[model samples]
Every structure is written in C-alpha cells, then in structure tokens.
Target: MNSATDVEIHAIKQVVATVEHAQRYELVEEFVSLFREDAIWTTAAGRLLIGRDAIAAFTWQVLPGAMKDLVPSYEVVHVLFIRPDVAAAKVRQRYFFPDGEPVTEEGGAPRCT
Candidate 1:
C-alpha cells in the first residue's frame, strides 16, 4: 500500500483551505495555482469548466454572486498515493447558506487536476 507524503498532504490542505476562503475572498490567483494547467472543475451548479483561463473567468464571474454566508467544510476520508507528486483525497464538502438553506452532500470525489 502507498501513502501520501508530508509535502503532498500540505499542498492538498492548502488547496482545500484556499477553496474554503474563496467563498469569502478573492482567491483566483491562489486557488488557480493549486490546479494543473489542464484542470477541470465541475460546480454544484452543473457547470463544467476547463483550463486555467476558463476557470479564472468562471471564478471572477461567480465569486460575487455566491451566498454571503456560504461556507465550505470538508472531511478527509481517504488518501491514495498515485505518485510522489500526485495524490487524491476522498472528501465531502457542505456549502452552508446561513440566510437561506444549507446544502449538504455526500458521495462523489473531487479530483485535483
């Protein structure tokens, strides 16, 4: 069996934190770096975005429209080592909408490309 190294774990944690903060701050520069050039992001809105340019545009467009109280929380379920530079974590993220309704989801994995 293989496991994630300390550096990889730290990188992943930073990515998660950046995402959590994006709900409350401008994190396009930070969050964009965590992903590969050919990254793909699928939003809960069913929108699929590809490449850094498109993703950056998407980020800029959506950040201001997100719920004011939107909060993202995640749980690390399992980590599999694909390589020293690549790893995947199985996680579930809940987006809490304080003034409206909280959205809870489980199942499905978010792959960091």
Candidate 2:
C-alpha cells in the first residue's frame, strides 16, 4: 500500500478505536468528543440529532446500562475517499453475548445513514 493510503487508514482507525472504546465503556463524553461540533447523527430508531450537544444528550441518556450483557463489534468493510480529508466508510457491526452467541433479531443492529 502507498503511504497516502496507509495514512488514511491510520487516521480512520483512530476514529474507530475511539468509538469502540467509548461504546465498550459507555463513556458518553469520550464518544461525543469524536464528533465535530456541527456534526449530525441519526439514531437507529429514526430520531435525528443535530450537533454535538444533541448527540451528547442522546448518548448520555441511553448508553448507560444499554449494553450490560452485550458486546459489539464493528468492522470497516470499505472506505471511499471523497477528498484528501473526507471519506466514506462502510462498517459492518453486530452484537453478541459475552459467551459468543450472536444477538440475531429485530432491533439488534443499528442503521447508520
């Protein structure tokens, strides 16, 4: 791989790592720190959150106790560079119990737009 590609991957991995860490520990502040001040996020259930404040509010409300027995894994399946600093990533994510049983059912996965 070229150095440019390697750099991009490394940068994106940092973002993913932060996300995973926040989710694993349910750290609302740390998770919210990853987003831009003007960023927008939509929940899997279709609620739209605009800006970091909105995202932080929502995250703090639900992250606690939401994954008491579930472990989530996120894989970056594809990454498309739109520009030198902008890219789109396709992620495959799923949840499983600590014992390794998959959580397969409706509402088990989140939809990202």
Candidate 2 per-residue lDDT, tens place, 1-113, comes to: 78998899878877887887788788889999999999999775778999999999999998998678878777677888889788998766677778988776432364333
Cα RMSD to the true fold for all candidates: 5.5, 3.5
TM-score of 1: 0.69
In candidate 1, the residue pairs with backbone N, CA or C atoms under 3 Å apart (3 or more residues apart, or in different chains) clash, namely none
Largest lDDT belongs to which candidate? 2
lDDT of 1 by residue, 3-56 (tens): 437667776777677776765565667667766889898876678999888888
Segments of candidate 1 deviating more than 4 angstroms: 1-4, 99-102, 105-113
* lDDT values, one for every candidate: 0.66, 0.81
List of clashing residue pairs for candidate 2: none
